[model samples]
Target chain A: MPLTPNDVARLADLARIELSDEELAGLTGQLDLILESVQVVASSVPPETTPTSHALSLTNVFRPDEVRPSLPVEDVLAMAPAVEDDRFRVPRILEEAA
Target chain B: MSEPIFASAADLARDLAAGTLSSEEATRACLERIESSDGDVHAFLHVRADEALSDARAIDQRRASGEALGPLAGVPIAVKDAFCTTGSPTTCGSRMLEGWVPPYDATVVRRLKEAGLVILGKTNMDEFAMGSSTENSAFGPTRNPWDLTRIPGGSGGGSAACLAAFEAPLAVGSDTGGSIRQPASVTGTVGVKPTYGGVSRYGLVAMASSLDQPGPCARTVLDAALLHAVMAGHDPSDSTSIDAPVPDVVAAARAGDVAGMRIGVVTELSGEGYAPGVEQRFQEAVAALAAAGAEIVEVSCPHFSLALPAYYLIMPSEVSSNLARFDAMRYGLRVGDDGSHSAEQVMRLSRGAGFGAEVKRRVILGTYALSSGYYDAYYGSAQKARTLIIEDFDRAFATVDVLVSPSTPTTAFPLGERTNDPMAMYQADLCTIPSNMAGNSSASFPAGLAPEDGLPVGFQVMAPPLCDDRLYRVGAALERVLTERWGAPLLDALAGRDRLSEGGRA
Candidate 1:
């Protein structure tokens, strides 16, 4: 399947990358070649074959629910670009539930 | 005192145990080598000299007091920039994480420290391990020690180059799609990519999550095996880590006997289009294995033809999702807009300026894979194809104990040759990517030098998922044979040529 320019634009947005017009144009052709090459996988196997989630079959390997102390807030926030009152300042993700 | 500068980890450990060399001296020699070589090779992104020396001094003092030391005690090893260190910045060679230091060490980093290995520094890499050549590194590409104008191989080029330049005896590198093995092959070093989940992935900056396996790079198989043994074993922090017992990798490598080993030569990996010199060296490696009492038989995994394509889809899709964490708000290098502009604008500006061109290209491709309507046709189907590749490997393993092939289609090309052509560079990994997709263990060691270009070529060895120990055994056996045939290790062949004339020297 071919990707529309709008599809590329939306993907770039979701990935937080800004694509230039020339880049998008070039990506269109390059991606087309790659997609076509990889499309061979579609017919490589039967549809009924169960998909393998992992190579090995060990299961239920979970860490004990021990509460460990995290790095101090000061150190954690130190790397952030915008911090206010010990909180990471981001463009507010919530706009009050409708 | 610097007697162990270029010694293997095994030799260094033995000597340290016998009081022939102190941990401090070993660390100092490595530091001195890095100081002299890094100016030209640019192998390290960050060097922690004081901390490393301090750790070495402590180990020496402990030994002097008759205290026990770990198997790799006193050895200095370089960590790839992708792994987080508690106090050191783990940038993954990208501007996005330029100043972002993790407060905790990666599982591998903690393991290395626990094993008493001195941390020399952080090596450079492709941005998020994304490129075939280190050209994508925000800090600039690591030059090949064999020829400065050529690439060292990515994204673990710096790790391999450091060992090749005799700066570090052992280094860590993550192989998502042949990053460890490819660079090792090009630089005449030893590297292994253990089965996925064999090494904990807890602190590695995620690239292609399912495919990334942290492995070792060193001058000798025993050195790589020693580091590998320490890095292996289960980690509860990494949900994907296997609970199986870590095999005796160092002992297996020392055994060095392939007698009665059923080695399968993959038919798909041989023949036309492969560089003649690469094929010649590969054949020589095969003959050496046969002379060591191993039987080589042709085996075919037809699904392998689909591996490269499957990898392209799966890798990009995963990269897009994994890299989404680097928005302007969280951490690291960011360019933000004032109150006049919206938050979205700040994210856009920051990411646009932060990422290199190749990284952006992958992110776009990945996003497209996960996009509505295309998900079923691309990512979903590619994953199903991954199942087929794994099954194919399983069936082949049932018949043969191990598989062998040329590590790459060609020797290391000039630096600028494939950087401009991403598709061509991607094709170079076609042979090695299948093993990663199947979650099998594979290794690459110098087979011989390509007669055409006089550059090194590597032969790859693959084994059943948990049979990683076998790769070391076979690789070590072949390393011995090839070294003897060449009259010395490949590194010695380039002795005088290593340093250029005063006019051309960097």
Candidate 2:
């Protein structure tokens, strides 16, 4: 399916990125070209083949249930763009229960 | 001791041990060279001169006190900006984390420090390692040392450029696709991408978790092997790290013998699209190996033709998911944070502001692929294709101990030549992506300069997982033959050019 600029705008929204009108138009064309090339995989892959999400045959890895030293709280908070009382400060999420 | 700046990492280590050269002197030489030439090359994103000098002085003191040190001790090395180092900015070449200093060191960084290697600061890379050339770096493109007008292969271009420019003898690079080897190919250096799970990814900023492998970059295969040994081994911090002992690559590199080894040349990875000079150098290197008593055969892996298409889908899907953490809350650049905007608005605006064009492109592509309607067609089929590609490697490895190809189809292209054309830029990794898909070890060793452009060309060697030693054996063997044929290492020609240019300036 040919991707329209609206489709790219929707994807950008899903990705939590606000795209300008110029970027949306440019990305739509570029992504259409990229998708056109990569879409070959859909037709080429045989149905019986099992998908390999990871390279290694991995099992769940666990460690001893003991506490280990972690990074200092102050140091961690210092990296935050906005720090509150010992925690990350952020813009409010809840719209006042109207 | 014999122009410390251009000496191999192994020779510098030997000199440092023999009391003929102080770590400080060697470190200063590299710093001075970086100071003099980096204006044009722009290889380093950061150069920690004070800290590197202090670390070198400490190593010199430890040696003076008669303490034994490891082989790479006191050697100055460059780290790719993607790795986190405490007390230094770890930008990963993005404005999002422009000046964000990591709270702690990555496992690789800790290991390099523990091995007593001095850190010479972080080198530039594609922002979040998304592009084929260092042109994606938010800072600017890193110019190739051989020809300043051309690109150094990337996203490890800065690391490779530093080695080619004689700024650092050893550097670390991470490869997801061809970031390390492709850059090494164009720069006349050696780069290794150890098997997935062979090296810990604890603090190397996540790209595609399944594909990323941090390895070594150096002027010689043996030097790469030495750094590889220091960096590889199981780290409990990264659950995917291989638990088995690291391959004895150092011994294999020193052996430098390919006698009786079965080397396969993949039929699909060559011809058409490949530059004639690149093909010529690769064919010559293969012939040299055959003359060295290796049994060579042509192997067919038809699925490899689909590697690029599959990688484009799979890598972006993972990229979209992995990059979600850059939301404006915890760290990095936060935009639209005045009291008016909501949290969601802040996230959208900040991400829109922080990321560059290529990063945005990949992230959006990944989002579309992973979205509801197209998930199975794009991401699922790509995963299935990944299986087929892995099976191709398994079948090829079943018959031969290793496989060979040109590291990239062409040599260093002129800077800005492919920046506007994403497809052209993506073509750089065509020959190197299959190994990443299958999670095998692969490397690029300097074959020689291309006849037409006189830029370096890389010969790639692929080995099965945990058999990384085989890569060194093949690379060392080829390096020996090529060095003999060229009458010196390929970079000596580049160095000769630098000398002539300097003399002309005088």
Candidate 3:
């Protein structure tokens, strides 16, 4: 199926990255081309082949049940864009009852 | 120009340990070259001249006291920006992490320091290792040292260019898809992508977890192998690290005679899309290898045809998921924070402002592929294709020691030639992606300049997982032939052209 501008917009919303109207218009064409080229994957691969999530087959990896020293708290908070009381500060997530 | 910093890391180390050359002198030589030529090359995103000299002085003192050290001690090297260094900015060439300093060193960085290698600085890369050409770098693009008008190949372009321009003897590059080998191909340097779990990925900025592998870059195959041995080993910090011994790559490089060794030419990676000049160089390399007593055979990896499309889908899907960590609250740029807006709006605005065009394109494509209704069709099929690709490599390796091809379909294209066309940029890694998908050891060694355009061309060799030594053996064999034929290393031919670039600087 050919990609449409509406599809690109929905993708932006899903990815949580806002794209301007002009940017969406531009992405529509590029996405369509990319999708068209990549469609070959669907046709080329056999149905019985299993999906490989990782190149190597690694099983459950567990560590010893002991605490190891980690990054200092001050250093951890130093990288945050906004910090309050040594914790990350963000905009309000909930709204008052309306 | 004062004193060429182009010596191999092994030679530099031999001199440094033998008390013939001081580490301070070598670090100064590399720093001076960087100051003189890096203005136009843009190979370095950050240069720690003082820190590097201090480290070199410390090594010199240790050497003066008769202290034994690693073989590569005191050799100057460039670090790709994808690896975090405590003293230098690990920007990964994006506005998202602009001016952000890492709290600690990447495992590779820590290993290099422990080996007493001088850390010159961080090199430029495609933002978050997204694009093939360094042109995708948000800060700026690194021009090819061969021709400043052309690209240096990329994501690891800065690392390759540093070696090509004689600024650093060795460099560290992380390969996701073909960031390291493709760049090394066009720049006439050697690039190695060790077995996926062979090198620890503890501090490498995640691109694609299953695919990203940090490896060594250098002018000679032995130098790369030397650095490879030093940096590779099991690390308890990273769970995916292979808890086994690293192959004796240095010995393989030293004993680089490939007599009676079978080298297979990958049938699917050539002919149709390869430029005539590039193919000519590849065939010549094969012939030279055969003449050196290596048995040549044709191997068909039919599934390789789908690798690019599959890689496109899979890499972007991983890119989207891994990059979600850079939310506004924790680190990096945050926008639309007037308190009039909510966290959702700030995230949307910040991401839109932070990521570049190619990155945004991949993120959107990934979101679409992983979204509802299309997952089974797109992402699912791509993973299935990945499986087939890996199986294909396994089958081929069962018959031959290693496979060979032109590292890239064509040599370096001009800077803006493929920028508008995303598919074209993706094709830059066409010949190199299979190894990444299969988690094999792959590398590109300088084959000679293309006769028509006088640009460097690379011959790629790949070995099955953990047998990285074969890559070095094959590469060193071919490098020996090509060097003997040209009467010097391929970079020797670039000296005159580099001087030309230097002349145009002022």
Candidate 4:
């Protein structure tokens, strides 16, 4: 099924990317072409075939709960776009709560 | 310009060890080359001449004090900007993380420093390693050194271009799909994608976590092997890292022998879609291996044709999930932070503004595919297709020691050729995606110039996981044969042009 501009706009919202109407229109066509090419995957493989999420068969890779040196707080905070009082300063999450 | 500027990493290492050359001198030569050529090449995103000299001088001092050092110590190497470095910015060719200096080094970068290799600077790449052509890079495309009008194949284009342009003797590139090998092919440099989990992925800004593998790029197979040895092996920090010894790639590279080895020609990866010049050179390479006493047989991997469609689904799915960390709450570019806009609005605006078109396209595609209704039809089926591709490799490797194909369908296409067409751009990696899908070891060697375009073609070799040595063996053998046939290394043609420009009075 060819994706419409509405589908791309919905997807952009789900992906947390604010796209303009122009971008949504352009993406709809390009993405439709790409989806058309890749849609063969549905028919190409047998349904009974098991999916391989990872190339290797590794599972439940766990390490001992040991204390390790971590990056310093100041160093970590220095890279933040906005920081205040040793915390990452983000835009207000809830306007009423704020 | 001096001879050492274009010397192989192996030769430079030997000279440094023999006390005939100082690390400072070699570092300076590379820095000077970058200064002179990188303006046109645009291979580097960042260059740290002062830090590189300091590191080289430290290595020189250690050598003078009779202290032991690794083989690659004091060798100047360019790193792809995707790898996080403490001092240098790790942009990954995206405005998202522009000028963002990483708090720590990537495992590969840490290893490079541990080996005493001088870090010259970070090279450009596709934003978050998304596009096949470096044209998607926000910084700008890295021009092909051979022909400035053409693209140097990407996301590792800068790393490959630096080697081709003699800016750096060795470079490190992360290959998701054909990022490293394709760029290497077009620029006439050597690149390897080691077996998945063979190299630690820690600190490598995730593109597709399952497929991304960092490897070495160099002028020669042995130099790639040497750098590979320094970079590969298990790291506890990366849970996916394989707890196994690195294959003896250096010995295999030096062996350069395909004698009595059974080599397979992947039937699906060639013909139709493949350019005539690329097919011609690949067939000649197969013949050369046959002449070297290797038994050649055609192996049909039917499912290989489905690799491209499957990769587009799987890679984008992973990309969507992986790139979600770029929320405006933390590091990287944040937009719409004015009091009126909420945090969510800021995240939406930042991601929309920071990412390039290709990135946004894939993210949306992935979000659609992974959505409630389309999950099984798109992402799940693609995963199943991945299983079949692996099985095909298994069946092929059972009979043959290694598989060979044209690394790309054609030589480097002109810049802006496929910028408007994502499908055409994705076709550049048709022959290369199967290896990544299977997590096998693959490398691209110079397969002489394409007869029509006079541009470089890459001969790709694939080996089963942990059997990465076989790739070096095949690459070295072909490099030897092709170099002999061409009467010199393939890059000599590019260097000859450079000499002309240098010798000519303006």
Residues B193-235 of candidate 1 have per-residue lDDT tens digits of 9998999999999998888999989988888898999999998
lDDT of each: 0.86, 0.94, 0.90, 0.92
- The best-first sequence of candidates by lDDT reads 2, 4, 3, 1
TM-scores for all candidates: the values are: 0.96, 0.98, 0.98, 0.98
Angstrom error at residue A78, model 3: 1.9
Tell me the lDDT of model 3 at B301: 94
Q: Evaluate model 3: give its TM-score.
A: 0.98
In angstroms, the error of model 2 at B253 is 0.3
Residues B1-506, candidate 2: write the lDDT tens digits: 27999799999999999999999999999999999889888899999999999999999999999999999999999999999999899999999999999999999999999999999989999999988889999999898888888899999999999999899999999999999999999999999999999999999999998899999999999999999999999999998999999999999999999999999999998889999999999999999999998999999999998899999998999999999999989999999889888899999999999999999999999998899988999999999999999999999999999999999999999999999999999999999999999999999999988999788899999999999999999999999998899889988876765732342121
Could you give candidate 4's per-residue lDDT for residues B23-128 as a string of tens digits?
9999999999999988888999999999999999999999999999999998999999999999889999999999999999999999999999999999999899
Q: Candidate 4 on A4-92: residue-level lDDT in tens?
A: 89888889999999999999999999999999998788987999999999999998788899998998998888889999899999898
**Model 3, B83-176: lDDT tens per residue?**
9888688888999999888888889999999999999999999999988889989989998888888899999999999999889999999999
TM-score of chain B for predicted candidate 4: 0.98
Second chain TM-score for model 2: 0.98
What is the clash tally of candidate 1?
Answer: 0
